[model samples]
Target chain A: MLVLELMVVIFLASIVAGVIGSLVGLGGGVVVIPILTIGLGVDIHYAIGASIVSVIATSSGAAATYVKDKMTNLRVGMFLELATTTGAIIGALIAAYVSSIALELVFGVILLLSLIPLVRKIGEDIPVTPELVGLSKKLELTGSYVETDGSTVNYNATRPAQGLAGMLVAGLISGLLGIGSGTFKVLSMDLAMKLPMKVSTTTSNFMIGVTAAASAGIYFVRGDVDPIIVAPVALGILFGASLGAKALPRAKNPTVRKIFAIVLAIAGAEMVLRALGI
Target chain B: MSLGNPDSMNNVISKVLRYGVLLSAAVIVLGAALLAARDAFSPSASLLHYDPNQIPHGPFPVTFSSLTAGLATGSPDAIIELGVLLLLATPVSRVLFSVFLFAAEHNRAYVYITATVLTLLLFSMLVTPYIPVFGG
Candidate 1:
């Protein structure tokens, strides 16, 4: 393909990936990586580089809206960031030692594992009552946000130590795989920390960019980030994520989630197969 | 809104993030335009060609000095790299801003927390590259 044609194709594909990613609550990296590597035959390292950059774009873009809505617990997000950033650095260091095939295999497994929470709908909708809140108070991991119905909801996070541990793993996966690892983050905030679902999701969104950025610098230094590849991917994902955010309120369909899940599963399996030389 | 309200802090941070993303996107689009124009003039250039072991045609600027040097030469890739760097820095800036926000609120605990997070981010992004094992 001509250079322009190739860039246009990658750009268009990234837009679709961004839309699906935001709609399904998966960040752009998971979808973008598969398209770049498995679909376009780009080298995994470059694909990862592009994917991680786009991850920052989409996350920051979406986070702006979420933060404005006051759903994101800024305190919790920043505090947990302490763990995620450290984990991201470690993960990036480890990425340097791992082979492309190994990276692909791990990416495939993480992709599949990420779906489990969405499949089971593990995030709870019930408002947390701020019980068992000693750690949250001590650490100030509590906040209030206005609900859609013009009511205020107050909540406190429980299990900070465990939450930080989960965030570390989330950051590790994000750095190594060049994805946001939002599922793990939501799990940590929702299941481990007992934060409300809205807080968990938005806070997870808030933190994703920082976690990805922590490792993106390393990728850039390693020369994995090609300007030509990342420019289109970043712009495409940013555009698509904005569209997805606007569409989300009206298009919260279970069927859409199911279809996206199946597509991601096939993509993940293909990645695993490719890594295994199948 | 009062400074005590959590919403006030979010309002400032959110604006910063939104503008940061927009600025980076605009910069990237400008870079892409330059690249397309260059390719249009020289039809034989395969800018999209990828090789894992080698950079495509020109030097891919990864360091700040190289980025500046490339920009001085009007290199489109350097502009794009600058955009990417700006995007990566957006979240880091947010964390940094949070330190100030917490300090303004007289929230000593969170001030310390945000500062620690910022230090970790800088350490990973800036300091780690100097370490032999982590850099490569």
Candidate 2:
């Protein structure tokens, strides 16, 4: 009976997650985990496991559309995998054995820390000026995305010498915290690598699922993949993401924006508490 | 990056080549090590450090160093994790790149109003990683 009720809740939440995930470049998992853990009395570990899976599902679903439009740079995506996957697996293994407590604590800190930029509302958007060697050339990385006027904004990266270092940090953070480091990665690409904001965002979304999957694999083997725990949260996040995305263009006020920082704060606290076994 | 002419293109490509080589090497040698320094696999270190009798007065390991230890699984280099992140980088970068182009064309009203809001939305993440300064 409880399971039946939970299923309904999960379905509803999935819709919510879908909406929220789209609104925020970070996948629904990051949002869903906290709500499920703190608001609904679910376990943190289960929240992460489910969150990552949902990340993959949502990313792939959304990525298909972006890729068809030629927004994604496949070679660049493939190249960075060298660092992200390695970091993810290591991060996950650490989650399982090394002070599970610390994992929980860090998870919370990361979520809360995200608010710095969120609240600051970074307004810096520089043009793509060539600084370092252009990695785009070696990888044949170039694409033209549709601008607001429906005209195309065509650009390429200069080896974005700054991007790789940023990516490594992004990978470590994502693997360490189990939240998609999409926000961080995008910032790095834009500011450090001088890539266009759009490319940085799209590429980070493409990378999160795989990174999450790496840590998730370890959790699964260690018996942390609790479906009961996952079911409600996954469904909730998926739903949230769907809602968030749909609301992106239509929401008159972007209602989700103001509360976003608050949500992050709560999630952070939840992670710290869980890590401490509170 | 003079693309309208063939000779200029060649010159541009060579310059890019030289930069890419120097940059990649720097990243591999410095960035990889700086970030990966904390991302290594050291299981028992965190656990050993987690003496419940210590300061936080909790059963869990709540320190930043311990949390870092948690990220360090058995192996420092985990291929699967790195691959996933690399793959994710594509879509994320694309979106960020797209946003900038869109924002560039906006007026102050649009920039202050819509673009700012959008970027906030863009970087909004759900999970966190900080130690709670105080109990609720």
Candidate 3:
């Protein structure tokens, strides 16, 4: 129970969290929260603080590679940020009025519902190219990335209005719960926007940093971001996320989709349990 | 990926993010190392047992003056906080830089869009603390 021993244990646990989080675009908070609160017996506030920092770490660490490899759709990410950031601010303002229990139940249901497409797409490696909407063409929300086979797969984002709306809700929940809500972001891109799984995961990874940063300052000011906790969590997540990032480019889309579905299932179940006060 | 094109913007921003994370990690490692060295001489209990009033709990409140003062004395906590501060700042700086990237592309529409995002970010981080509803 010495301070040195605590740091080493937490640092080791965070590496596993980082790997799974970056692989599925969950930002690793899901893994970090339980490890800190349940395993380390850290206060929930401090755990949240550490998780938020890990979210940023996972985003930046994984994104550094995704962006350079052109897997992240930069234009799509920036365009969507307009909605997510606005939604986040609004969610924060209205959080005082909203019942967190109801919100959790609703989020849980939505996440479970999002699993349908992933389940259906289990057999497909890449998403079939969809007809581009006029708005997509006008916005130029299209890009291409090279697959493991060295062939470039071109893709376009459809249903911009709906996609943006989903991002708004994602941001709202993120601010409301003080969680990254990366599941919703990936769902928006993968389902509503009809983007490829690789792009959705990487783009979600790319954007979560900004989304989490919006609330991270508040946590820091509140003194919840203990340096002893955050330091190991951040470093461990960065290392793990870098490993995940390297593997993702060569990872199959269907495999990534399956991993996302499994993680979503776990997160959704946890939300339901928390809402029920279990 | 033509120069000044939106595609090229990714390359620039990627490098920024990479270096930002690396720099913060370096600072954090230094602080953790310092903490380990300090603890080796005068051992403390696990973080869970630290006094709630101390940095291990919810009382490491950060401010510009306090941060600078602590850094001047080589406080491990402040150094780690600075690293966290840098980590938080990376995405904000990326957004700010994106505005310039958009402007360079001569894409007025995106410039406005990116700028709006940046404004919202700043508002949430810097302005909301004044609003009592947010528990600031």
Candidate 4:
């Protein structure tokens, strides 16, 4: 009975995380970690392990739909993955040597920092810039995505170097912290590479699975992933993400973004407090 | 040279992603049900607290022979682990599919790039375990 109860609670929390994560273009880890740790009293390592699995679940679930819709920029995502995968390996190696407290502190800071982009872009559609940098032009890293209203939006990605650099850092943080690091990836595409918000978001979604997979192997090897714990979390998130994907086209963007910003703020403070041993 | 129709490639990839997630989720659900049933017979301690030090370290030995043996025994843990393996394989398969798509399009630059990513992914999954320091 207790086992069933635990599974139900964790499963429900994961579903909520997945819904919020898919709607806001964040992976479910941010919410999963807090819920597992603070709400359920799970150890941080176990929470992270399960959360990483949830990230892959949400990423794969959403990416499937985004790819079919032609919202994902495969070219850009593929190109940047080289750096991200390499950085993931390095970060995983570093994680083996670092202390948990230090990791928590870093995770807290990243969570807080991720909110800036969400808050800054609130209530406004980011305009597409016309110019592409030399590298972007050489790679032909531009694409068109159809909006909800059936209008096509074409966008060019500028500053390939900056985007790649940002992805490396994002990957590093993702592997170390066991989160999707989607916020950083979107910031790179939207702010640095000048991709449209929709493009940045979907492409980031597509990229996260591969990034998380890069480090998941390490976690698996380290025995951090418990199948019993991950099974429910992964399955729950998969269902929730699929539902969120269906609703995304009809949902109001500004409202969702505002809700996500508030959630992030609370999650960020909780992480900092936990890290401070409070 | 122009790559094969990017649209067709995207469709194939999307199908792979969708089916992969669905299949893995189904398997995990079955495994969870089995796990719950098994736990009912012999209840273990709470799942919430696990000591990192007490758990056996190193990559799970998921070779073909072991998986077959475990499946024959109907081990719930093995089934759950297999689902996890499939979940991980979804993205890895995506990378592999991209390699083929890039090659079919005769896009040499992307083929090489995608191949490199595939190699890195394989190395992490297959090679990382042997490198003692990574607990392989």
User: By lDDT, who's the top model here?
Assistant: 3
Cα shift from native, residue A60, model 4 (Å): 0.8
Displacement of residue B56 (Cα, Å) in model 4 is 9.5
What's each prediction's TM-score?
0.87, 0.55, 0.95, 0.89
lDDT of 2 at A153: 60
After TM-score superposition, what is the CA distance of residue A271 in candidate 3 from its true location, in Å? 1.5
Error of 2 at A25 (Å): 2.5
Better of 1 and 4 by TM-score: 4
lDDT of 2 at B96: 40
The candidates, ranked best first by lDDT, are: 3, 4, 1, 2
Native contacts matched by each model = 0.81, 0.00, 0.64, 0.59
Query: Model 1: residues >4 Å from true position, as ranges?
Result: A23-25, A93-124, A127-132, A144-154, A249-278, B1-5, B43-58
* Top candidate, metric DockQ: 1
Candidate 2's C-alpha runs over 4 A off are A93-121, A124-128, A131-134, A158-161, A229-278, B1-136
lDDT of 1 by residue, A13-67 (tens): 8888777655544567767776777677677778888888877877787778778
lDDT of 2 by residue, A1-278 (tens): 23335445655766667655554445676566756666555565656666765675455444443344445444355455545655554454344346646655765676577667655654433354563344556454555565444666666666454566666666666666666666555556554555555455556555665556444444443334443434344434433543444344333212334444454566577667767767
- When 3 and 4 are scored with lDDT, the better candidate is 3
* lDDT for residue B96 in candidate 1, whole number 0-100: 83
Using lDDT as the yardstick, the better of models 1 and 3 is 3
Q: Best to worst by TM-score, what's the order?
A: 3, 4, 1, 2
- The DockQ scores of all candidates, in the order shown, are 0.65, 0.02, 0.61, 0.48
CA RMSD per model (angstroms): 3.3, 16.6, 2.0, 3.5
